[model samples]
Target chain A: MRKPKLSDEDYPTTGHEWDGIREYDKPMPRWWLWTFYATILFALVYVVFYPAIPLVNGATPGVLGWSTRADLAAEVEAVSLRNADIDQRLLDTPIGDLGADPDLTRYATAGGAAVFRTYCSQCHGAGAQGAKGYPNLQDDDWLWGGDLEAIVLTLKHGIRDDGDDDTRFSQMPAFGDILETGEIDALTQYVLSLSGQDHDADLAAAGPVLFEENCASCHGETGLGEREQGAPNLTDAIWLFGGDAETIGHTITFSRYGMMPAWNTRISEAQIKQVAFYVHQLGGGE
Target chain B: MTDQITEPPRLFEAREPVFPQRISGWYRRLKWRIMLGTLAIYYLTPWIRWDRGANLPDQAVLIDLAHARFYFFWIEIWPHEFYVVAGLLIMAGLGLFLFTAALGRVWCGYACPQTVWTDLFILVERWVEGDRNARIRLLRSPWTLRTARLRATKWTLWLLIALATGGAWVFYFADAPTLLADLVTFRAPFVAYATIGVLTATTFVFGGFLREQVCTYMCPWPRIQAAMMDEDSLTVAYRDWRGEPRGKKHENTSGDCIDCMACVNVCPQGIDIRDGQQVECITCALCIDACDTMMEKIGKPRGLIDYVALSDEPLERAGHPPRSIWSHVLRLRNFIYFGLWTGIGAMLVVALFIRSDFSLAVTPDRNPQFVKLSDGTIRNAYTLKINNQTGFARDFHISIKTDEPLRVDLEGTAELNVTVPPDGVLNTRVYIFAKPEFEANRAETTPVRFWVEERAEAGARTHADTVFTGDTQ
Candidate 1:
């Protein structure tokens, strides 16, 4: 850019001189002056075309007829259209059948992950890492059986729950009244020994007879509880109540009966099956 | 060095008219970029869309005040979670303080709305009426048809920008596209138009007309900033030690300064930096830019006008220059501020973690403590208000437990299965009646527990407790 010459007509001279310093009052460029005018014209056009002046009653709607709500609605409609195919497919196919289709399975898994975060994360931690007293689905152990069919049944019919008829009906008898305190203690030791924990040799020996007479019906000969009856396996390291001697003694004396809530009345069977398959896929199902 | 110092140089200078001559430099470019960036974001953010399923607005950023909902991308904020907004404001304040302590007035100079809009308006003026010199000359010129047209055109552009600025602001409050349409069709709500008008007037007045006067006089930031600044704070400064004993170039050999008044001429705020730091100075470095260009032309050092804190100060006892001011920014005051800021942030996060999903309140019917029913049963009335804070609608079953065999009788619905809309409050009047035998055995006042259980699919349940009061036996 060439510097314009400072002429007396175009430049206004500053009279103040400090150490021979002076300023020229030069006129601004005409192009710059026109741009300012252009901006004003644009503003007027904008006000006339869009919402601008506020009347006593309300704002004056411009001629362009644009609105934020309409824009948002249009955007939402576009997104909904994009997801329409997958959403329709989800509705058409049974949740169980979704497992067979890889694309559907992927979609369901992602959808399940989001649902799990919103609904299941409170009790079962965000990562499905169960806290104390809550069952960890990541492991192979299942109190109500791990098979897809069995899981679906168990979810639909909660254990010992009065609300649903399909509930898994299994209640450990209160041995507190049946067995003597010493006998209960001996059986507790035997149960602990089944998991390979240290136990009193004499007590374990006596517990074998007690186990055969009272517990073997459900626990089986080797103390590996029957899954059909919702009886827990005794050979595994994992314990529902506790593995400690005191806890084992208490379990035998009181007879622990943890309840799994019935979902038939709350959640549909399809949903239960979907959740069951999801839990089975957690990698621990037998 | 041998010259004896009589009195220390005065800390302040008498006010002098700046008359800054405009010049272009790196700092000026940086300011322009920032101003443009901020303006684009402000005007365009309302148009961005986010998918929020059905029955939800898709605007990326929106504040649905009518429904008490705030949408920011994927996160949805409810009125109950207003604490999040409060926490954010606190965080912003602390962040500003920290930034100010480190680089004095950087936010004011580069990022403040006032600075950005004013710069835009100034650009518009420069484009229309020419630069500072041209504008000054035009002001002195006699009134003519061309001059009037130019002036009118400039005002028109300023007004349009102001209107747009105001219009964009209301979009945040409602759905932008629909409101725009409503605005055009003349069907938009009155409040929307009123808000836009107010904003437009303010933008035009503050950004176009008042301009520098707002920053120099009206704004409270200058007063607060004075206290925030320390000697070590990095600020736009003229190196008096180098530029003093000023004289024009090719005339007298004294100091690096050419006595060109370029720095004063270019200043938007019209403040002279050579007169020492003033409260009116926004530290925009425009003056530094003006002086640097003058230095380049005069073959003097560029830093004759530069950003300097107290790093150049000499240690009185040690006889060496003390540590740079930057190191002091990380010292006790800043550390304490940081600690409090983090502490509050952590507390807010913890509070969010512990926040309950359901809120419930129980109020006993004051009219009749206990009514003797026709069937020989005593009845107590209660109003249970339940707040469902979840995203989906929920059905909550209400049950009452007391010493007596009391049965809950909901006034309207037989089943106490109340359906509470998402983020909504549901109020139900419940009547508890006791069998004659049970009521006869009870004391004058009976303690009862009101329980609300949300039975969700997958067996997920949430329970809240309140109390149902009954008259004494």
Candidate 2:
């Protein structure tokens, strides 16, 4: 090959020139040219292997015959298969039994977290930190017992419920009708004294006799509450309703019965047990 | 030094291509305003907050894929109502067509992703390598270290822009705050990273490299827009009657013509409007601003290049009275498009109004079709799936309605009370047994209705109907 000479006559140029500044008729870059050809080849391959070309009725199904719908179905099937063992285990094991296995417990907790966020998070916060009316699951203070069995029972049969028979039943009598205002005050002071709160010694001494008459049937002699009766312990520092003097007086004057909903018909029995364990492991569960 | 005088460097340098040094006019200012406004909106929308009660996402525009819900300020879309997304896509298409018919290719010029990205890329190019003339000189110059450095800087800026574009896109799919945290910690979901990678590559390829080619050759909108346009539609045009018999400045004795090529240089699509309208022209009107500036400088009146309707051009040429064709934009074609668009919108609204919170589906147990009881009662097994789309948990009271005195039996519980968790579905197997007398009275195929009533809310009810088949009566 001979070297080309650099001469004005040898160069191809645009016919028009401004003050001898000529435009060279150079071809496009080789890389750009190759890229163009490669892209056309890629498009041909893509059309042959994918649903690219539109036909009269529907798009052309490629040699692979793959579709977005099929891909989605396959993905769903894969996920389902991955979770099948855990799902089957969840179906087979009793909710109470779920907490015993750490793996199942982890799975249950994750599942319960999603369920709680969707269902219970409205009343109870997303973190299960309850509002004024809602009971906080993170706290140790539970109106009912905090064991898995107790929580399951509570979920299965709601408290003060009219429908189911096994519901936790407690009816504090209207002490307002039975006792005078002064007597109610004495009783409230007496109840507060059970938890070592300050009270009039003479009034508390006299209130013992009043307690034996009306409240001793449900609450035991020492003022520790009964679980079966759904009566709260008076001796404990944690209060379900409230511990203030006026609140105690109001409770005596007009007995408050807090209603807990039955979640058994709504959530699975196992889920209730899982939540119970989750709550039981929280600071105050007994 | 006096003997070496060089004729004052030939008195004038060669006029290089420099975008014809066009002055910014109304259209150019409008384009700048739109660019600034759109960019501001896009970058700031993610941070706007809307309180959606407690425990719900606060972002005004959120696609909570984890929750399978989309929240747009006051509106919330559930997964089951994905048809809303389909409706939105249809509305967008129709809106584009409407805008195209009224003012051709306006979206491609002002709002399209290709146009926006290409404009951004061009801005970066201008910042680093200077404007059109400087770019051409830099390309023609021999490979120097300074030129290489400038090229490198431009590419870095372009890559950064492409990355930012990709990064902003993933924020729409998840909670922007959480995803940002996860991304920083390298704990983002695999899908998020994969999506960003794909988007980054596409943005770099299409925005930085492909640029106007995406609009001119790749996009299908220009092809579709050709059919949508009519003679009365407004388009950027060259008034050849006013500008032809073109010649250089001081030599323009014919038809007020000046062969400056200002319009050609300022055109983003690189098309000559004087050659008449072509598919590549996005109608950006940079050319209008350029030509207007040139006309003003040459002591000629403006609108040698202007927006005009094809229908009025012939009439004006024939010396007939110019008819106002703005009213023609609302012709039969537009009316039909509007009708269909409104009809779809109205149907979606009505469907939204009638949407139910509770749904019931029945699946007949195929394994054992019918179980013959000891008391000669015919029994059929079925799995009833109940979906509660409400936000709160509901206590469902299930009852069977049949032609005969059919008794419903649950596997474990005596009461047919089901509690469906909020926004959840429950599948429970149910057994229906007919009394012997009722079985004797029943036909081979009997229709049975399963009704679910929410105890907490009395109004919420759903029903599923299925046929109970028996072996030889």
- Name the candidate that leads on lDDT: 2
Q: Give candidate 1's whole-model lDDT.
A: 0.74
Off by over 4 Å in 2: A1-33, A36-286, B1-23, B53-56, B64-67, B366-369, B439-441
User: In candidate 2 chain B, what residue range of length 10 has the lowest lDDT sum?
Assistant: B11-20
Docking class of 2: incorrect
Q: Encode model 1's per-residue lDDT on B194-305: one tens digit a residue.
A: 9999999999988876667678757898888788877667888877767768887677757778788788778878766787777778988888888878888877768777
Complex DockQ, candidate 2: 0.01
Query: How do the residues B1-473 of candidate 2 rate in per-residue lDDT, one tens digit apiece?
Result: 11332333232222122222334899878877888888767766776788864556778888877878887776777887899889988988998788778788889888887887777777777888887778777877899999999989988888888777777878887778888899889999899888888888888888766666677557888999999898877889988877777888678458665878788777777667887888878988888898888888978988888888788788867767556655767778778878878888998888888888778888876534554432345567688888876556778888888867777776434699988877678877787776557752256778888898878744678798998866563
What is candidate 1's TM-score against the reference? Answer: 0.56
* lDDT of all predictions: 0.74, 0.75
Model 1 residue runs over 4 Å out of place are A1-286, B1-22, B251-253, B310-322, B349-358, B364-380, B389-391, B400-406, B412-414, B433-451
Two-chain DockQ for each candidate model? 0.01, 0.01
lDDT of candidate 2 over A1-286, digit per residue (tens) = 1122224344555566889867654344344566679999999999999999888999989999999999999999998799779877876887667757868877776766666777667766775656554665654456677666676687678888877777877889889999988788888889979887788877777798899998988988888888778777787655656677888888888888777667778877556655655544432345
* Pairs of residues at least 3 apart in sequence or in different chains that clash in candidate 2: A95-A270, A140-A284, A265-B419, A266-B419
Residue A36 miss distance in model 2 (angstroms) = 5.6
lDDT of each residue in A13-129, candidate 1, tens digit only: 556667875654434434445657999999999998987888999677889877787889999999879867976776688655776786776666666566556655676566554
Error of 1 at A202 (Å): 75
